[model samples]
Target: MSTARFLQIHTLHTYTAALLNRDDTGLAKRLTYGATSRIRISSQCLKRHWRKAEDPHALSTLAGYVDAYRSRELVTEKVIEPLRGRHPDDVVNALEPEFQKLVYGDKADKGKKSRQTLLLGESELTWLAAEADRLAAEAPDAKAAAKAAAQWVKGKNVSVLAQNTALPAGVTGALFGRMVTSDPGANIEAPVHVAHAFTVHAEEAEGDYFTAVDDLKKDEDDSGADTIQETELTCGLFYGYVVIDLPGLIKNCGGDADLAGRIVHHLLYLIAEVSPGAKRGSTAPYGRADLLLVEAGARQPRSLAGAFRRACRPDVEEALRVLDGHLAHLDATYETGEARRYLSLAQTPLSSPEGSGLERLSLKALAEWAAAQVGTGADA
Candidate 1:
């Protein structure tokens, strides 16, 4: 019987599952290690889990990999043993090949069964049984043991393990006691959440901005001279917040307030171009203003609600006109083929209670109405 060398490996499955179940704000808080900037999951997670399925082989392989590392004696003898007196870098480099072989072995022309059953029968069985035994041993009583043994193993703690990995400089800012970084250039922080995405869905039409503007102007005045004289502008308003990992920002910027401000501006500009709207205070109101933030909590509720209420002030008709003009300007400037194509697609008219109109909309009212529209559209 071949004796398997032990290794200690940590898995992030449980942490990821917890993150996935959490609300965006909660997730942002937990993941942002103290940076002012928000961190999001990399494209890697999206690709991996988007279509992943449970496979017995994969599960068994993971179990074996974990068992090999869980043994303190084996780990000491195999891994830490070699590093006792050696430099860390040299030790890591030397151990890499051996670790790889243990994790993933080459099996040329081997039968599936033989490859699947790499460890001896007794060893494999021991590996599988140890997980249950460990839980049982750790429990305070028999009842607790039984319950714990039945609970599925979700592997080691990830946040703790990730702490062992060092973050790059200028990537440690605090958001509610958690660390986050806003240094756009720093890439050490693991992307564990996605705050926003730029796809075909948020774009607008090429001529839609101009058309909307022209229509709004024409509606205001039927006089042909006034219509022709109105400035033909194109623009859109894209609103969203880039969660700055406050700690990370401080770390990168060395606590430079000016640099942090620049970073915020740059990120806002980037997100704005993706959506159809001129930035806030830059142009007239578009059809609707989207508030995009890494977490919903990032919004200053009183201030935001006040702004929306002010937009609707004077009268609903005036507000709509303002919104139209703003949206038109945004579309004209940032209307890429991607955004234009998305706008060209047919959309259902918003379904509302009979006689619902802008006149009835306060900031809070508008938000509620918009929420209903989204819910109905999604259901449809």
Candidate 2:
């Protein structure tokens, strides 16, 4: 068992004129809450940005981390392609269908079409390639090879095979989880619960009209813009919430408490520093959280989104005050005495209720404190 059952994290980040996330029709995403419209960023978008971040705090940079591929072409690209020239064409061709069926079940296409994208770790893919090669070499013809592979699949246990891999679903899958409906055993329950971030107040957005000029055109030429378009841009203070299930995370990392601790540490940085945006070059959307509050406790986690239920002012200090007030209300009603630590960049710090020992620390110290709560001091 871990020291803490859950680590609840709440953050307030402000962005300038940038389209952080967009709808299908190319407009800034919005959600109506408390009977008011607010700019929204999906949890999926946040997870993707954090998973693929290239910064020093990126999960991919962790030691012993394996890459995972989520795609429809996983069998072809990772399993079959590597074995194509190395083995006979007939043998290689025969293994594709059987592997596809093994992975995607009865609905799998014979010509390498998957019912859905499969998320597989590098070790699992490597194992499949080796298994295909062995089955192919033992068979007399393509027909025999296919039969042998299919028979092998029936007799084997995929989940067991997956567990045997050095890293089952890789770092991202371990953190964000993966769903393989074909095989429930392959599904990993996500330990990190991310809420869709929304603006504290009403949406503040505008349509930005832009033109693309043809640099090669001379003054004598058409003297007109090559292309013109409009895009939606919004600026607001977003409230982001995330929950870490310590026991779940530790189990997913194969009982490595130290590794789990490091993961938590790096994840804190990713959440606060990584900015999810649409147009990077044009928007240059990047900002760190102005206020970060972390709570460690053994009880179920709750979000501070109620702080913005009535829509506070755009200022960070106002948001903080509202947040503190809401938290106090929850404490008074439920008496949930969760150990709390916070970091703030605002001129006015968080005002905790008297006798509620809420320690304020810097970002580095905050992350370190979270890692320690998970029972380790190792660098992320």
Candidate 3:
């Protein structure tokens, strides 16, 4: 077993004439660093793309993986809907309010049909459905069923009950985490941490005014285009960062170091290959990482975003050079004993300072090497 506690992955990817992420106003997201605006992509957006990608390396392909759902109607769809025809209508209907009150707050009113969305594991939903069925079968009436459910809510533990059905956390919950405001025991702390990606240089965008012409327009009709619109298109070289807590990942996987290792391997592939974008039909925004760097160490993870505080040139070589200098400075000051591997598409080889311990490797080798660092504990 390796003695590494943290695995950090960093990448530099460039996209052209694409709108990857947008705000409510239909513009590219931006972040101000060093008093200059930089195009940005949120961590949430990046994770969604990676998690939902239908590739060979997807997390859904892992053995013993349970699917997870996020929705405001978890109780309605999973519990109440399944029991509608199987049990008495009144008994099943009574569960909605009780379950809502349990999940939301005691004062959750019926007037608001849409509540805060929640992430629930498939096992947890199955358990809830089974409980509803049992209550419907045993209750003499809806009132008794409601009272019994309230009592169950007051006494029973959700995490314990869900564990019987299947893996309660699911793969996504085990990696990204789940939050239950009313039930603290159901909450899972995310072991994988993601940072928002931003361009290394100042923000650059263009206003694209476009129109679609109707194909069946009559002759001499002199009609205008069928539709007209304008959007913001941006070209940028973005720097992305992700960190995996080895011990926390193993704990989330029920102390299975092998499973944690497999997860890390698959996640590394997704990070390097997945493309996050909006307006896919029009923009066709897709790009692989220009540089992929993986680091393994026992120290707490730190982001290298500060290297771009002064905003490097848009060229990948220039950005990488700036990063190399910053890394040398950090190593000199902290003496962090981290093992590093990287793959670069640049023309020149990466220059690491003496004793920096940075090695060059292919993406496949880098991913495997990082996964091999997963162990049971810090002292493993």
Candidate 4:
């Protein structure tokens, strides 16, 4: 059977008044939701947190999935150190443009050494580094070497690497993908859709007023505070959603369903467990999801955010009723029969269609069900 077109994961989490993500002026991030104001966490913040939360074992299990390198400096560091040992000083210096242009591409500005940072997968990186070594062996002149190098990588397509169906899957590349501004052929569309998390109920941000006293100047004349500042914070339940394109995943992994399954398992855990780390020292807003909904099906994806269009209080009973209503409306409007949903929450479980046959599964059981539907989520 064909896997679902998309994997949608949603959560509702309650956090205290400590700040999570900060804005440009060092205030807590906020956005308008449900016709009211609500605290917001950007998709970038969530993705970054997920990337950092990965353990060595988790990465290793994803089939040697090295994080994509978008920095020319970092790429240079990886490419140059190895060459320094074998090549002459002049040759090493000359090879920079060859490797840079080959891996990256022609620069936008005429005189720049390397183009803008582009996403290069593990396989692409390894291949480029090997090609650099080959260029050194083939010629001695920098211009000739660069010409040959350009010819080598410029013709390669990102989709080909994306559709690679081999082992040691390029995890980050296969999912997040890479884009080269100068080369359209090297652009790989990201298969994962990330949504900015926003509060279901809108609440105005409150400022925490405080002052720090100076330790040394404790005299009666110097009785004033050394520092006085205000920091913004919000307290509310937030809703976050992420959807994965199943066919896109298969294409990205080159039809490696087993690898995709492992990645999905790890990704779900990451999304559920990781919290945005902003103002960690003073305003550490650490919270966990009170309700998690993980679903897989061939039906077109939808969000339950509409349930809070009028905004409701943080009452469990009220929230449940609203969620059920929105979901029912969605099904009625779409008549999406090929959908499967699973829910776990703190309140009384809604009967039958209230959850739309969403079986309440344990974390382990949820992963198992997803694996059974697609492929084995076995450890690499």
TM-score of each: 0.21, 0.94, 0.94, 0.83
Q: For residue 304, give model 2's deviation from the true position in Å.
A: 0.6
Q: Is candidate 3 or candidate 4 better by lDDT?
A: 3
Worst 10 residues of 3 by lDDT: 105-114
Clashing pairs in 4: 164-254
lDDT of each: 0.26, 0.84, 0.83, 0.67
Best by lDDT: 2
lDDT tens digits, residue span 25-59, model 3: 99999999999899999999999998899999999
Best-to-worst order by lDDT is 2, 3, 4, 1
Q: Which regions of candidate 2 fall more than 4 Å away from where they truly are? A: 1-3, 110-114, 219-221, 353-356, 376-380
lDDT of 4 by residue, 164-192 (tens): 33422256657776666756766666778
lDDT of 2 by residue, 86-173 (tens): 7789988888877887777677864545467777888888888888878877888888888888788884544754867646888777
Where's the lowest-lDDT run of ten residues in candidate 2?
Answer: 371-380
The C-alpha stretches of model 1 lying farther than 4 A from their native spots are 1-239, 243-248, 252-258, 274-380
Candidate rank order under TM-score: 2, 3, 4, 1
lDDT of 4: 0.67
